[model samples]
Target: MSEKRIIVTGASSGIGEAVARQAVARGWQVLAVARRAERLEALAAEIGCETFAADLTQEDAVAALAEAAATFRPTGLVQVAGGAKGAAPLGETTIEDWRWMFESNVIATKRVIDALLPLLRRSTAAPQQDGSASYAEIMVVTSIAATVSYQGGSGYNAAKSAEKQLIDVLRLELFGEPIRVMEVAPGMVWTEEFSLVRFGGDQAKADAVYKDVQDPLSADDVARVMTDILALPGHVSVDETIIKPVAQTHPWMVHKGPLVAKG
Candidate 1:
């Protein structure tokens, strides 16, 4: 039997890295994609998987990712190769900010999936022996901010919501063929890449973003949930998942658990 092929995007850090690492450990052949060559190389070395250095924001990059996928002929894909938006008041928003958010979230995802359509189909057509399931999974990592309104998130919410809608519709379109579409929505995860990228290297601002929320869910938490969803018995599919910290009531509300003030 051929080893299971899994493709993970945004695999350089955060939830993507965690999922890629975990999947590789489960005897799955992982194709990790991200723009940071050094990071991807280090991860590929540790996990003994293939790595591709491509910025998902570029259409060509997505095409390259698809070409790489064709070689592996993967049965699983985790679309975690997108970026989050920074905190900025609506009135103070820049045009570039809006463009970057859409490019990274919506366009990038569309491009990569479009390129890998054939691979996904192959997985659905293949058969597994010994009662093991050989199904294809296309999972997207979205944010709770897309569903709930929050200040300073107009552009970001719109982009994520668009992708979420696309996935929801595609889910229905892909039914009855063994191909599954799912989305994992997370709330207030504190990861080094996420915080640094969203805050644009402003450590102070990023630190404050999570200071009020006690015990915010880490990237590992989300990864565990994702892996569990994949490990379920045959014919059991998790369509949608929402994960958040206990203290976070919603997108805008944070319960500020006890903590010493930072000077």
Candidate 2:
């Protein structure tokens, strides 16, 4: 079978990094995109995959990323470059925080998709080794907050909800095209940076968020689901997958145990 290439955004760390590594391990070429040049270089050194350092939220950087990706002609794209900002109540949330959330999550996803459409279309025309239909896949990693609202989560929830809606509309618009749009909403993922960044680098607060959880999902756990969905036949499209650790029922519901900090 011919090699399959994929572009993974937010590949500097967490779920995006895991997806890039896992894809490379599965014999697929990966173009890792992130804002941290040092981190991307480290990942490329470790995994031997191409790396592009660019902030997707910037128009010029995203355009450059798309141009590089077009040359690679990746058959798949995984948009994982998004996060939550200040966890303030509706009235307390600053306009800047809300705008940042929307820009990072919704606007960035749309920009990357728009810039890569030509490459994605070209991928669709390539012949499949198995003689099956050729399909280019686009996966977005949204959060469970997209559907469920919680206290002090209005800004994040709104942003993620918009991203989800965008994916839904894209799927419907590209129904007959050889492109598959999928969304993965993960809950309670225990990544080192996610909570830390959300809490403004307050280690204590970040640690408290998952202190009592029996077993929280790791970045790789979420990436595994993405890889599995991508591995499916081109004719099969897993439209939306909501994945959570067994201890998590929803965004607000979680099974808490004794608080224990790992050294």
Q: Per-residue lDDT for 1-263 in model 2, tens only?
A: 44678999999999999999999999899999999999999999999999999999999999899889978888889999999988877998899888989999999999999998789888878678877668888999999999999998999999999999999999999978999899999999999899898888999989998987988999999999999899887668999999998878878888798435669
TM-score of each: 0.93, 0.96
Each model's lDDT comes to 0.83, 0.91
Best by TM-score: 2
Deviation from native of the Cα of residue 120 in model 2, angstroms: 0.5
Candidate 1: where are CA atoms >4 Å away? 131-133, 259-263
The runs of at least 3 residues in candidate 2 whose Cα sits more than 4 Å from the true structure, single-residue gaps closed, are 258-263
Write down the worst ten-residue block by lDDT for model 2.
253-262
User: What value does the lDDT take at residue 255 in candidate 2?
Assistant: 77
Q: Which ten residues in a row have the lowest lDDT in candidate 1?
A: 124-133
Supply the global lDDT for candidate 1. 0.83
Q: Per-residue lDDT tens digits of candidate 1, residues 77-139?
A: 889977766678888877887888889888888888888867888876646875465677888
* lDDT against true structure, model 2: 0.91
